[model samples]
Target: MNQTIQRRLYKLYSSSSRSSFGLRNRISSLGWIVVCGLPLCAFMASMYPRDTFFQLLGVVSAVCIAAFVSVLLRKAQLKVRRLLPRHASVGRPLEYTVEYTNLAKRGLNNFYMLDLAPDPTPSMDVFLHATEPGEEKRNAFDRFFLAYRWNWLKSRFLLMKSKLFLANSVGGEKCGKVRVELLPLRRGVIHLQNMRVVLPDALGLFQRVKRVDQEEDILIVLPKRYRMDSFDFAGQARSQVGGDSSTSTQGQSGEFVSLREYRPGDPPKHIHWPSWGRTGKPILKEYEEMFFPRYGLVLDTAVRAEQEEVFEELVSVAATLTSEMDTDQSLIDVMFIQQGAKVQTVGKNVERVEAMLELLASVEIDPVADWAALKNAVLKHADDLTTCFLVFGDWDDERENFLQSLSSFGISLVVLVVQDEENPVKLNSDYTEITLLNVGEIEQGLASIHL
Candidate 1:
């Protein structure tokens, strides 16, 4: 992951390009509009002096000449190289570098530089303005002397540096880490397949644009944080303080469950020779696997807050737990809170949960989701499972009722709730619950839970 990110940044820093036709056309159109229309418009206005037309023409001509000169000076290939951090996490700062040279023959004066960036998605069309060059000193502020000429005969090169941070926009405030990268502009199609721009127009008009072309782009991606605690899962397991389905016996002895006639496919170690001899046939022994009685995962898409991050963490936890239990003959299942489908009786390498993660990552939040209907669906499904791992946040009356219904079904429930700052969950119930702050804790937390 680190190598892949570093290579992309390196490529951007080493790349360069000459001015495009689009830039030339826009600048020319603006200059011509003022140069050709100003004198005519001033002549029509009765309030101005009769000689104003001449003065306007001279002023417009000089401005047009300056515009043409600036365009000639601005034609150059800009090479940008940014340095980004490895092992990227949520709410962490990333660093990058920007480098470019003035490829024109003469010094480009009074011009600002802007790099195009990518859009964050859906209906919000916005691009990152990586760096902005400050305006040069106005020519009017210069001091001139007799017999002295300005040294404007030779072309010059330019070097500028800049930085930008990556963050999440919540309640109109940006939060999270500063991310950076360096990539060299090259010959290939640098597809910022998802690019957009929200910027001021030539006349200071605010315009939002989504770019869909073969060129011009920016590099910025959202982050995922690394955490090491699992309060929800652990709390769920400990909730059963004194029950018949408590912790397994400490001894290594396997508990007996039943016996059956042995077939050719039965393992040799599991064969009960004595019992087989009495019946003149082979018999096999079976043991009930010691495990948490019920483990259920509930995915509440109704909680639209930070939906993407929540989805990632939920999927990571489910996948890790499923993989661990599979190795030890433990059963697991995942239930979607809103979606009717549930991943039940999950075996090794269950594909349903994997599919769920991808779906979750892409799903956008609908601010007006129907929580009542979602709760009803969960209540109906909770009746059939013996042990379930439920993943969710704070509950209302409907969720509380569904949880209470599990008690009658003899189900042992373990809940893994994703943590939030202002909405902390209380350890108020006997049912085991674990709170996961971020995806980083999934592996370590599973290692500590035996059943």
Candidate 2:
């Protein structure tokens, strides 16, 4: 019975306003009404006759009822379509157009529209961090007092504050457009659900809303990218033994090959003017394999329960490097383990920067075996790579040994270990390639690195 009541309350809160003000706003408005109305009623009772005071109260109640009825009787037929981008980025504002067509005979006025965006999934870290004995006991004690449920309710209300809302007025049988702006707080798939339209009474005391069901559209928000212009990886491109030129970027010295479609980062001088004249399309001349610098991006996916934030910082670092590094000059192979060992190449005409960030946004922490699998996957390309960037969640003997192994294989290594405050930044003076970055201070760390 308590659960049922909570559910009903939640529904009422969600439906109260298109702005998503929820129950808190409703209660505040009621309090203000009583605070002001009671004083007026008391003054009238003292100064005016009893009959007059009662008549004034009755007139006010009738007016409120009439206003509510006016809104309740209103009917509108609306057709809505969302024009959104293919993807959005975290902490960036995403603007999309919502086109609405009013099919009702009468116009709509003082109505607000809200796009129903799904909530983000809770991270496993939240549950795992609370698994300690003391924490668990505290949680059990809180549950006994129903504090857990209250906390959940508070979280739900806070989540509603992030929803997007727009207000507009449209004439009968006319088309209107509303630009909606949303700032995503995290990286994930943002699913757009139904749209709610709230029509308030003329007095603005009550609102009646209608929900227009929409075909869900999913938008993936990529992880945040930072500036890493000062960072550099030293390497040399290996010669291709056989097959076609596998280099994604243009070679500094190579024989001219056949002409192909032009890529975004391709140098303008490489454009084949003759081919463009003949084919009436932009084309670029390919080149033989030359000194193509190939770098391996080794991402550590094995994160402990409490290291989720560090893992997220690792991902953002990868994304930043992927964006800042000129793929037109070198090839970067991003290697990580999801369900299994997977490698994604970004350089030349292989893949775009957006594709790489999308992959990073969805990567989750895996088991230790998965990390081992990633090592094996990188070894397969060992011969081709001249340098490797190792991004680790923590630095232990196992990780140190792995870096040493890579160094022994003639592969120059640049290591970045993400650490928390409790874990002080410690560097082995012997390994010049290693750098320690505290979580949330990545920009400062990168700027401090001279090479």
Best model number under TM-score: 2
Error of 2 at 301 (Å): 1.6
lDDT of each: 0.40, 0.69
Model 1's lDDT to the true fold?
0.40
Q: Candidate 2, residue 444: CA error in Å?
A: 1.2
- Candidate 2 least-lDDT 10 residues: 120-129
Q: Give the TM-score of candidate 1.
A: 0.37
Model 2 misplaced regions, further than 4 Å: 1-67, 119-140, 143-165, 233-290, 422-432
lDDT of 2 by residue, 1-451 (tens): 2455445544444454334544332223543474457558767977886987877776666766776677677676788888988888877888888888888878987777777556422233332223332234565455334335433434432322234365578999998888877777667676777577766666666666677645677788888777776666554233344233343333365778788999899989899998899999999988865555677898888778557678878888888878876665577899987788889998866788788888887888886545466768788778877667888887666676677767777766777887887766455545676778888889888766653
TM-scores for candidates 1 onward, in order: 0.37, 0.73
